[model samples]
Target: MSLLNEDATIPFISRYRKEITGNLDEVQIGEIVKFKELFEALEKRKISILKTLEEQNVLTTELSQKIHNSQDFISLEDLYLPFKKKRKTKAETARLQGLEPLAKMIMSQNVNNLEQTASKYTSKEVATIDDAMEGARFIIAEWINERTDIRNNIRRELERFATISSKIIKSKIDEEKAQKFKDYFDWNEALKNIPSHRLLAILRAENEGFIRVKIEIDSERILQRIENRIIKSQNNCSAQIEFAIQDAYKRLLFPSLSNEALSIAKEKADEDAINVFTKNLKQLLLGSPLGEKRVLAIDPGFKSGCKLVCLNEQGDLLHNENIYPHQPQNQTNEAIKKIGSLVDAYKIDAIAIGNGTASRETEELVKKIFFKDKVDVFVVSEAGASIYSASKIARDEFPNYDVTVRGSVSIGRRLQDPLAELVKIDAKSIGVGQYQHDVDQTKLKKSLDTTVESCVNTVGVNINTASESLLSYVSGIGPKLAENIVNYRNEKGSFTSRKEIKKVPRLGGKAFEQAAGFLRIKNGKNPLDNSAVHPESYVLVDKIAKDLKINIADLIGNKDILQKINLQHYVSETIGLPTLQDIVKELEKPGLDPREKAKVFSFDANIKTIADLKTGQLLPGIVNNITNFGCFVDIGIKESGLIHISNLSDTFVKDVNAIVNLQQQIIVKVLEVDVVRKRIQLALVK
Candidate 1:
């Protein structure tokens, strides 16, 4: 924790400061970072609570000790409840009427003549002794409600036995729109066992005013427990104490603890949902890339015609065309001739078709055309391509082109490299997550940012050609520094060496040191600069090359020569075997892509729509989205099929990731089809 406080990023601490952190990995270090922030927040809250109590002149030695000793916010809040100021509650009004002393006397349980004692307090304000005792009972009920031990025990009960139940708004139940949430209309489940997706669905329905939801516990059991704690004697005051206990349990404690339990459950659900979203986002971002290739991409549409753009190997848009391949303008012959000409003229390597409106028709059209060269056709997911099309990045890149052409360009680049192209769009708009919008937006963004950073750093970036969006995710470079790096490259020409990066504006020594290793400069002057070997470690590589009696260039990618060198000779106080091993590994595969090359996936030719799906029909499918429940697979149809976790394999499967991954092509057998819902259920072919 102390090490993390010194501006040390997770990757730096996990990779470089292993000795200080006992060799904790990135995930463990990230957890420590989160908890450290949590502790600081708790400390701030403690200070605020202590100051508030002191200002109210109610601070006591025992109370101060308990507050200082609290380990969680709930316990601390339970202790502070008695002193918290607020709008006039029933108990506060009674106290203002001067019934607190009488309440204290009633709680003492030593008063035999309770009515006679209450008579002494009777006045114009009291009206009658019964009224006075009633006010005392209200104060007593509040006192019972405020006891920390009592509140804590009730909280435990709520946690152990709470049930979340929802009911449709009576008038909305008959509405046609309410059918979408039919499953949750009469839902009742144990709060502890409810899955994150279902919880979020329920919340969304409640938010839309279709249903009312509440957490419930056994009220009688709670009353009995409170009575056992507060009712001490069988005297005249005992009956009043019992009444107060029941009043507190029913009116205050039960409601408060139930809400608290629901809060905890909601928080847990949010975390679970966020984790799912983060994992899905990571997989989608790191999906296979068809390395730099000339791509003719198409954004398929019916009335608007298919928006077409030809891109060079570097994803530079060279030409744009609109072809009416389907529908009202069924100029198939003209579209086919034009496509063949474009393929021949541009020397196209691959065809990327956006999996959107009229995608199947466009794909059929493209495959039917006789190209001069054999071209591999890819159906790319254009989930957020439209969002990126009208974005500022797209506008800056292609000022003369409209959104249709820009969208086609995005689809083309996404096929060329997913990580680089997808970074320009918001993660939430990618449509690869479950209940994303329902989760905590702040937490979701933080998690997605961390995931993007991890993936970007894992697969090093090309500093010379990377966009500001891609460069911004590098280790230490942010939006401003990324823009400056791009501007500096434009003005100074392509960087000949990694050291030239120091000339970029506001890129100080610290920023360069953190970011330089993850930013690759291919074909740079220094061989080690193109590799992950940090500038600080260049001396170490030079020493190895000197020992071999050869130039540094010969030392890189020479596994046989590298093997003969002794690692122990290079060990020092600062550099250890872990880093030395990493250097050797980098030398072997310097500047290599960590992702697999993209492959063409085709669905069953017979199946073009959900209506074509039949039970027991085997078909090829690509895993598109994964969740805790299952994965959604695109089987070349208008409706994607769902492979539930149970149906993923013949044996019991605990995690869906263990069985399948994003964009993995596999064969599956259809199990069921719902034509009305446009749903297909499938099982993985053994």
Candidate 2:
């Protein structure tokens, strides 16, 4: 591949640089790239090995083939290991002790009786039968160990049928820190079916040293089969050597083969689990929008009075009230007046009720009030609301209001800007993502942070409503300066223009350049704030509009003139042809929310649990999760239904994810519903 083209996008290469990737799809091309890198590295390694072997006069054609055919890094290294210089061992010593002829004679099985075979080698060096037997056993062990074919066959067979075994040692022998491994002791399970979570659990346990574990494939049948194959003809005289060879295969070969089997199994598990997590993350970041809602927010409570905050169409909180809706029976009159006035005064469009303790009761009250008024309302998921409420961002924004009022604000803001509000809280606290804690924390944090960044950048921020927490998530800024910007704004009053952001502490030209376009300021000095076109691109926009001889207002959404512009003319090396083309397309449809369809899905009102489902009953559901086992659809939040791997197919389905995806809208028929455990099994209806 050309180095220049290598750095380009897969989409670009697949469409334009066909010669480099051979007209392959994105996935196939990615695999080819990875394989090519690995092959090149392998070739370099082979050259070094060949040079050394040639110097030693040990390089042979057969040996070269074996080395080249090694499938992985481990197997390649293993192939080179025997020829590697090492310390003296029992087998090496046996050869030096003049017992080679006797060992080879017994391996060929040229004698009948054990004692007779032993006696035939009765020289001074192999003086006794015991000494002769010892040398013979060591050679046989080495023979079995070196047979790569036997090793590969046994490893494959073991993986098909082996059980992993472990035993916990006594407490006194192991430290207190090692006690966690005790549970894994004496455990036995098939390697193929074990999950990644469980595999890692066992690995952690093994690291603690309270357990001795082995992957034990019942190789009795295989050992007997090998004996029959290798021994060829059986004789009473050769029986002793046969027994010794079988013992060597069992003691020396089985464990090593089992280790290889486990490695392969773990690799497969990691691939599957990684794919599952990545899909889940992508789906979560793609949750539907409620758009810009004019919300009447209710922070549900009982003892502590419920805080009511009303926001405008742009999500700026316009009114705040504290009501004892669920408690303080005497305060009922005051509560009614405050709530009624706010709803009527601002023409509060929707009641964004928090799903908290008094949420259902509050919903009931809103339903009664809005029923006559023709208002819409939705019970929003209030996950991590408390975290947001107590946060510094919340306090900074709504200093006059208490935590309850801040919570109410968050609920309203979340409805208006899910991506913006969600970024403020930790993703783990949001209850999405994976076994986040168990995985490499730094890696997980990096990935999750990227997901949030991508989502935020895709849906540009409203600079006026954005808090420091929200602004930090914008392309260039971070938490510290985001806070500084908010502080500066608080002191300086509402930012009238995007250009004024440079006045904030440490907000230099570079930061402003990266962040300017994404931080939209509606009704700001520049009309481009309402769109995605940056201030740096303001000249470009004016130039285009000038050439077209139309006003900037008329220039937008007019596809005919926009398409005629040569993007290559404006493109610099820093901004390539690809980037210029994308910018032009984006400018055509500025401030577009790059998300999946913003469709609201409501489950059956009566069906709160899986027990309410019936087999063959078709239900319109949202795909919550997709795994190798099957797709899981959420009829309601209480539980999701599983469509097994078998049911994921009208034809053969190798990967269930290929058939369906996370957060996708699909209809599924309930196949089995278990009420007690709250498991719902569903199959795609179509």
Q: Please, what are the lDDT tens digits per residue for candidate 1 over residues 1-686?
A: 76666555676666666657777887887788788878888889999999999999999999999989998888888888888986888888788889999999988999989999998887777899988888999999888888888887887877788889999999998888788899988989988899888998899999999999988888888788778877788998988888888888878888888888877888888899888888888888889999989999999999889988999999999999899978899988999998899998999999999999999889988888877678999999999999999999999998999999999999999999999999999999998878899888998899899889888988889998899999999888889999999999898899988889999999998788778888898888988878877788898888888888988887788899887778988889888877888888899888888899999877677887888878999999998999889999999887889999999987999888899988889999999999997778999994
Question: Per-residue lDDT of 1-686 in model 2, one digit per residue for the tens?
Answer: 66323344333344333444445655565556667777888888877777777788887899888777876766666676556655786777777777677677777776666667666666777678888777777776677666666676776778688877777767634576665555676687888778665676676666656677677765677777677666855664256556666766767677666777777776665555555665565566666666775778888778887888989887787888778867655466576677777878888767787766766566666655633365676666676888988987678677777787788888887776677777778776765433444455554565567556656666777776677767887766778878888788778877778889899899888677667767777676666667766676677778878977988877777788889988777765344565456556766786777765344444555564456677778887777566556666766545767788788778988876688766667888887877765677788875
Q: What is the C-alpha lDDT of each candidate?
A: 0.88, 0.69
In terms of TM-score, the best-performing candidate is 1
Residue 513 error, candidate 2, Å: 8.5
Cα deviation in Å at residue 438, candidate 2?
Answer: 6.9
lDDT winner among the candidates? 1
Residue pairs clashing, model 2: 112-237, 113-237, 166-186
lDDT agreement of model 2 with the native: 0.69
Tell me how far candidate 2 lies from the true structure as C-alpha RMSD in angstroms: 7.9
Question: Against the true structure, what is every candidate's RMSD?
Answer: 1.5, 7.9
Residue 310, model 2, lDDT: 88
Angstrom error of the Cα, residue 495, model 2: value is: 8.4
> Model 1: how far is 428 from its true place, Å?
0.6
